[model samples]
Target chain A: MSEMREATFLILTALADEVRHGYGIVQEVSALSEGRVALLPGTLYAALDRLAAQGLVERDREEVVEGRLRRYYRLAEHGRTALAAESARLRQLSTAADARLRTLRPRSV
Target chain B: MRRLLFFYPRAYRRDRGPEILETLQEYAGTSRTRLAVNLIRHGLRTRLGRPASRTVVVWAALFTVACGLFAAAFGSWVGWQTIRPLHESEAAQVAAELLPTQNLKVDTDEPPAKFVIYGQPLGWYSVRDLLLGDGGEYGQSGVGAGSNGPADHPERDLATLRENLRRGGWEFREYVRPDYGHEVYAGRGDQQLDITFYEYNYGASYISLGMDRPAPALATVGGVLGFLAGAVGGFLLFGWASRRTRSVFVKLLLGFGLFFWWAPIVLAFPQMVEHHLSEWHYSWHPLWEWLGQPALSLPFLLGTGLLVLALAISALARAQVRRADDPVPG
Candidate 1:
């Protein structure tokens, strides 16, 4: 399986919680990633369009609170499944690395 | 900056022009040393949908050159027509009469249709109508050239003169003003005569005649040449553009070809070949004649239609072949 980039992982993780508008999703992902990535508007929208085309996410609803339109998108079942598989894969890799590092530790002589 | 107005999609510009400008201003403000480079790069990308590649620049240069050549060829064609007299019988004789006495120089070696007199300058329509036979008041009035001020009414004078000539036994069957100017070709059989008047001003006029030859041949050749120039220019532009976008190339070719063929032709360099030319004849009393070199516009019309049809078919075939090679994913 291909490893998901941090940004993609954070996006999928944010949507795993609940449906969110574009701005809300951005804020949620930023908070979850601890400010490591600041996605530009172009990058964010491009990713969203691609993900939506793949049937991983979809527009759930739309509402206008002010002059601007707020579109909400929800994670599809396939997206949740993919996120779970990515998480499990990452956990296995991390565990194996930790074991290797412990064995390489220098003993007190 | 102004041309950037055409860069964006029309609907998008209409909706967000001010907003886009405001955003660009803010973006540019953050950079000082990189301002020019940044804007130029972004502008190219936006207008061309690609970076400023050498290929794109080369294509643009090629398009500009093709357009320039087409304009030059058109100029040459029109210039040749303006100076040469075709064989027009009654009209040629009338044009010859209208010439001032001092300008009546003719060479026996020259064909009857090739005679030209020089003296005073006259407008194109005034000479054309008189030589080709007038369409009466409406035509004269529409061109603002009826027998009033030469600037505003050459048509009227030419019309009245044509009516007189018609009554006086000059015969005109059909004619058209392809470019500005008048011509009449007459005679009984395969042999014909040509008379043309042009560049008239004040009371003076310049006229010429060629006898015993058909003027229709001249008209046909000129018209065909003009049509070819238009189609060839469009084809060159399409070839240059299709490298990047086939649909855009096809659309532009069709649109531009139609525009050149059907639109009212406006002379590009009108002032260069008028009024002050030494060949204008101004000394003679106005003599009118009726004649015609019929079917002038046919070749241009037919040629344009044929070329457009050919290009459209080629484009369709290319599109079909491309689709067959790469079927779309359902």
Candidate 2:
């Protein structure tokens, strides 16, 4: 089946806290990822639209500031579920790799 | 960590860009550079797998191809219209009338009715307008004019004109209007050019070419080619700016500043200088001269500007998305 990419994962991660507009989502994702990522408008919109379509995210509300329309998005129940699944998968992979390395390690003399 | 954000495509950056940034600031103590790199690398590879990017690019390419073919075909059709046999005879007959009575000689070797002008050389202005009567310079005067150049100057050297007429393939004619003055018309058929030396009250000389219809096929094709050229050039420059400066903000500013304000302004330089920014020539109409507005003046300027803006914005948005997910260099 289809799965969301890491960028999209980070997008959901940003929204995991609370609702956010376009810029707000970017800010949150950056904070969560430690400035390791950024999003531009085009890419953001494309993902937002796709996630909303797939029932992963929903438009929570709209606000206007400085004469610009900003649409705020929130994670849907489905989005939370997807994020949980991905987190579990990453955790499992990390644990398995750690275990394998420990068993295969060379002991220091 | 701050710089690693450059790895994501622009779309990824815009949606999650701010949050990711804020998160980085909040979690600065961790040595997460390696994780950031891995995330970016994964982000771009995933973005490339996206069907949307391919959809946009392919649609754009198809549109360009359609436009190019349309222009070439319409231009070719107009060319075909000018070379039909009857119009050729008409052109030859008209050319004969422009010659003095003494120079008109019947050619028995050819068709009995066919006559040739066998005398003195004529001045360029006297018969220049009549040569490309239907497919004249005027029709190609719009955006296509840049591509036309002097190759289609109609008034070929006298030797070529004479040789062309002797082959008996095309005809030339003359048009006389009390207001317009002595004119020569030449065409093979539907395609014709009526060439006339127009003298303004100010003593400036001008040449006017009229066409039955403006070729949409040509213009559509030309517009598409123009769009593709603009898109490719625009994307590369913006992408490079993002890389060199390591600033999305800078890239956005430069993209809009150059594409919308600078490029069109640059393209308009020649026309603006020539016209001196005066009122466009076709702005007013005479009371009785039922003839419609002559083509090519202001519409091209505004149309090109609008077209460029639309393409630039689309490309900018796409680039922003691609850059958002891009990985920063080590």
Candidate 3:
């Protein structure tokens, strides 16, 4: 399996709980990353297309409101498993870095 | 902003166009350029994203090249025919007047294939028959290949030839255009001769005589029959194309039919129509003669056909997008 991209990871994480439409995913991903990562519609859709092709996320449904289509996407079981693996990988790396930082602290402190 | 969607291939736009437009409408304000660029890139990606798309592209390219080759071949053939006054009976007769073989130095103890066309001494490479037949021998020197004919026909002056033909009741049918090579045509009593005098290569001017003038009724009937056959062929080809266009093999056949038959149809039909309508000598005119040459005609037709094929593909591609079903089907 390939490593999950940051935006893709966040997007999958956003949909881990429930289904979300394009705008909803963008909003949730932004909030999940604390505004550090904003998902542009173009990048978001491109990744969504790729992820869908990989069977990671699927279109849940589509609805037309105010003459505009809103397509919803949901994380599949495969996507959830992939996300769990990626999160664990990040946690392990962060834990090692934190332990190393502890040693570099000022001795006087 | 929606217009930016046009940058995508038609099929891509069709499949996800509505969804994409809705997204761009709501979110693409400050970053519209980036969004547009990304969409354009993805659109192009999807257009050639599949094996089917690649196949279509390859076939189209092959067809384009085939069109060029067909043009070159047809042009040279037509040019060769034009240089000979085959259509001008009087000219063939003047040539026939010299038949059974012309005066030659008889160099190298090699005798040219001597034949009589309306009694003219017409000498051409023996291999001409072989080339026309199953034989593929190309070792012999080509006719008019190196401009071996005299600066003019050696036996007679242009004036003397013309007067001789006229006195023999032959009428001037064709001549080299001003300052062009000394080519002339004349005919009398169902016989025609075409003469070309090469200035540098003295003592030989290519000459041919023939009695190929069929009755006007026969010619018209032949043209009509040929047109009918062509129409049937065209209809059959169109039917084949309509059946399935995605197959590479089918596309190749379509390409061949379009360039090969399409050219002759475009070229010969108009002349036929005019000939039957006005009952005039439309073909006899010198201006229209070169158009029949294969070298010129083939390329002209193929180039035009390519343009037409491109337009047709573009139209078909656009139409493919409007179905609102699967966008990227083979």
Candidate 4:
């Protein structure tokens, strides 16, 4: 498999724990990325549709909250495995980067 | 938010619109413009469905561009209809005034027809010729006059002609002195005139003049607007049809339609560009001519038929229904 995009990885990570609706996923992704990645409703839905089509996510359930329909989504078996692999790959890269940083002289600034 | 949902396909809007609205509502504090733009962009993408298939986007783009070109041509044609044809008598009078000394013969007294085949108005009789190998014979009608004998004083006549044209309110656009002789282009309002002086080594010089109208500014502006409208409409239609049908036969029909419609344009466009670059055109050949129309009208019609058939089939086909267990309403 190819290396996962930051947004996709974050989305999968967000859904790894509990089933969430569209807005829930957006909030979780933003929180996880330290507000660096603010997933809009449209962007979130597109990504959700793509993930669902790939069988990496599945529709979980629906709720009526404040007179609005909220369709929830959950990570699938394939998504869990893919997320694990991506996490390991990221960890390896981060470890190598940390080692390189330790060898470099500190900036005066 | 509701208006933004309009960008999505009908079936997609039905299935997912409420959920998307709910999500958007939750982020109401966010930039409405950014949110609206996002909805529109993704909504259009959603209309095409098949997120995994990259080729669908390419096909949609091609179909959109073809529709844009065709619409621009049609719009230009509509704009051309506003022009009043220059009468043969008027042309002859102008010719007489320009070359008073020379006994010029008016070879063509053009009929008031937008298009002609073999010097006659386009009609049922010309249909066969228009569709057949003689399609190139179909062309815009114009008045022309030529002189057979050599001018008594070629240089003096040329000078007098230029002065007469200027005094007659004709604006000189281009003047070229070739090895053979001189070619002058002048225009008055929408109408343009081309004068050529061909010098023979044996002293038998021939001078010819032709008058026609250039495409009005309306055509240029209308064509641009039409192109934009056609692009949007074509893409939306293509997306709707693409999502509604998974039939291989429909895809095949679409493929054939694209080939039939786009082949002529692909083949003719480069040649037309070369032609335009090769000469100083007072006005370009009409847009349809560049698309190889009339000559290739049969193939174009066939392509249109195929595309319409494909669209009809897609329209009749049942949209994919969401599973009953799925929470989203159809």
Candidate 5:
């Protein structure tokens, strides 16, 4: 079974909100991951190519800003589903860790 | 950034170059060096038509040739090892002609002839190449070693040896050979026998005999041809396959290639001193030497293997997705 890479997950998460160009998603992903993940242009674009190929995210529109044609991408139905599934999975994992830490935490102190 | 973009396949760049460039400019915190390296790796070669049609060529060729070359080298090493045992058996065969009661003689049956002296086997030493000719034909080597024989009395045994040779259907050179104490020569078909008796010291005599049959070099030639064929075929396949799959595996493979492609640039003295900001006190030579080890090459093999595995995974994932059609199971 093919597991989604963290970068792929982040890319999908970035597109889940609205249509965003390549740079927009890169910045958004960094902010969303809280600087824990910085998407290099190559990595971000490569992930975009893969996701687009997999029918996850797709080209939304193209706009020329500052003489550079920025292509925007938005999540497809599949992309939304996949992102939801992956985010839910991660949430479950974080919740488990949170529960485990709660037991380990000092009680009533 | 533009230069780095060239590391990608031209076709790929043709399709997405403008958009990617725009993204790069718009995207803050982009590492040009890392992106360049990544592009070089992933953009290795362009894919042909589509990803589905392109076969994994380099990985397959690498696997086959690696196995073939190793096997060939090992077989050659082993064949060279057989020279000693062969000489021993040849010596034994020669020894069998003499009465052990009168003189010490050891005999065994081992083909691929060699010369034995005083029961000590002597043949080619440190023989690097072993043709080991095929078609039931074997390679031959002649060796001559001096040993004290017959109580160091060649004068007493010369007449007796001559008589034995005559009886054994060996024709001797009737004339005294040039620059030799005593020499016996006999030939039958392609095989030649030569024995030289010389004085080793005061009242000490040493004798040497060598029998050899030169074998054809067809096997080595065939081996070389086969190796070349495998390499060439693999290269052609790579050229074809690279045109098909524009996957990350291909990109990384070429990115690794960029490391090699610019190796000379990296190693240039001026570039090392100036660009790399390193003092040129010959530290690079040691690094260069260290990197040249056969073990270092294993990383290349490992990296390629990983890429091939990734290629497989990509193909499988796509296949699974296609099989499922619409909705993919989480």
Candidate 6:
């Protein structure tokens, strides 16, 4: 499979631990990215629909709160596998970059 | 939030509208303009469906361009309706007044119709003839006159005819000499005149005059507007049909329709471009000819029938139901 986009990685990461509603995912993604990635409703829903279509996510349940519909979503088995593979790929890259930076640091000093 | 939800397709809006609205309300402090724009963009995308299929876009684009071209041709035809047809007597009278010698025998033929196939008006009876070898004979109608024999003092006669046309309010452009003949073009208002003189090595020569009208400005303007409208409408309609059905037969019908309709245009466009570049045209050939219209009317009609059938099948098919486990409601 191709490497996951940063936004997709973050979104999948946001859903890794627990099932979340739309706004919950939005808030979590924002916090995960240190307030750098704020997903609007339209963008977030479109991504959710694509993920669900790809079988990476599935509807967990639904509730009514203050006369508004709140639908929750959770990662599926395929999504967990994909997330783990992507995480491993990123960790390897990060470790290699850190080693290179450490070697450059002593020469610069 | 409700107004922004309106941008989504009807089914999608019904399924996920409330959920999306609730989310938008939570982000109430965010820019409404940005939210609205994003909603509109994604809403239109959702209408197309098949999110993972890249070919859907290519098919939609092809359908749109073909539809736009056909609409433009129809608009140009409507514009042509404004022109007044030239009578055979008018052409003969002009020929008689312009001829230098009274002895030259001139014959004038009346135009059968605004457009004709093999000198007759197009009709159901002529469809076979059109589809056969005679298809190339389909052309615009025009009043024409020709001299039976070579003109006496051909060079002097040309000057005399040019002077006579000038006196009769005709504005002459520079004459062109192609492989076949020396041709002079002139215009007065909507009326256009082409005078061609053919000379052979054995001193055999004759003059032919063709009188018609230039394409009206209204046709050009209307054609452009029609193309724009047709393009947008075709794209939306194609998307609607594509998303409404998953049947393989319907997709095949659409493919066949596009092939039949677009093939003639694909063949004729480059040749027409070459013709335009190689010749000095007083008035352009009618719009239909470029589309290979009545000439290729058989295939055009077949394509139309196939598209109608495809759309009918799509209409009869049920819309795809959202899966229970999908996060989006429908």
| Model-by-model DockQ, in order | 0.04, 0.03, 0.28, 0.55, 0.30, 0.54
State which candidate has the highest TM-score: 4
Candidate 1 second chain TM? 0.30
Best to worst by TM-score, what's the order? 4, 6, 5, 3, 2, 1
Model 6 over residues B198-252: C-alpha lDDT tens digits? 8777776688887778888877877888788889889878988988887899989
True contacts reproduced, candidate 2: 0.00
Task: Measure candidate 3: CA RMSD.
Answer: 14.9
Better of 1 and 2 by lDDT: 2
Could you give the TM-score of chain B for each candidate, in order?
0.30, 0.26, 0.32, 0.79, 0.30, 0.77
Candidate 3's C-alpha runs over 4 A off are B50-330
Model 4 docking grade: medium
Interface RMSD, one decimal, each candidate: 7.3, 7.8, 4.2, 1.7, 3.2, 1.6
All models, RMSD in angstroms = 18.1, 20.5, 14.9, 7.0, 16.7, 7.2
Error at B313, model 2, angstroms: 32
The residue ranges of model 6 lying beyond 4 angstroms of the native Cα positions read A1-11, A17-45, A53-78, A81-109, B1-44, B97-106, B165-171, B174-178, B221-229, B319-330
What is the clash count of model 3?
Answer: 39
Give per-residue CA lDDT, model 3, range B1-330, as digits (tens).
677667556776786788877776766444767777666555543443432132333433334343343343333333433232333333333343433234222112112322222233233653243324312222112121122244243445556556666777866554454443566555444333344554333334553222332123333344444445544443333333333334454455456645553464466547756855653221242222223322234444454565456446645654675665656778
Residue B147 miss distance in model 2 (angstroms): 38
Q: What fraction of correct interface contacts does each candidate retain? A: 0.00, 0.00, 0.58, 0.91, 0.64, 0.79
Residue B129, candidate 3: Cα error in Å is: 36
| Model 5 misplaced stretches (Cα beyond 4 Å) | A1-3, B1-7, B26-31, B45-236, B239-330
lDDT for each candidate structure:
0.47, 0.47, 0.53, 0.84, 0.55, 0.81
Give candidate 4 misplaced runs (Cα > 4 Å): A1-14, A19-43, A50-72, A76-109, B1-6, B9-41, B49-52, B110-112, B174-179, B216-233, B277-280, B319-330
What's the DockQ of model 2? 0.03
TM-score of model 5, chain A?
A: 0.88
Candidate 3 lDDT at B324 equals 53
Report the alpha-carbon TM-score of model 2 versus the true structure. Answer: 0.36
Clashing pairs in 4: none
Cα error, candidate 3, residue B248 (Å): 23
Ten residues in sequence with the least summed lDDT for candidate 6 chain A: A100-109
Model 1 alpha-carbon drift over 4 Å, by segment? B1-330
lDDT of 2 by residue, B5-65 (tens): 5656677667655554543443334457644744455454334333234242333333333
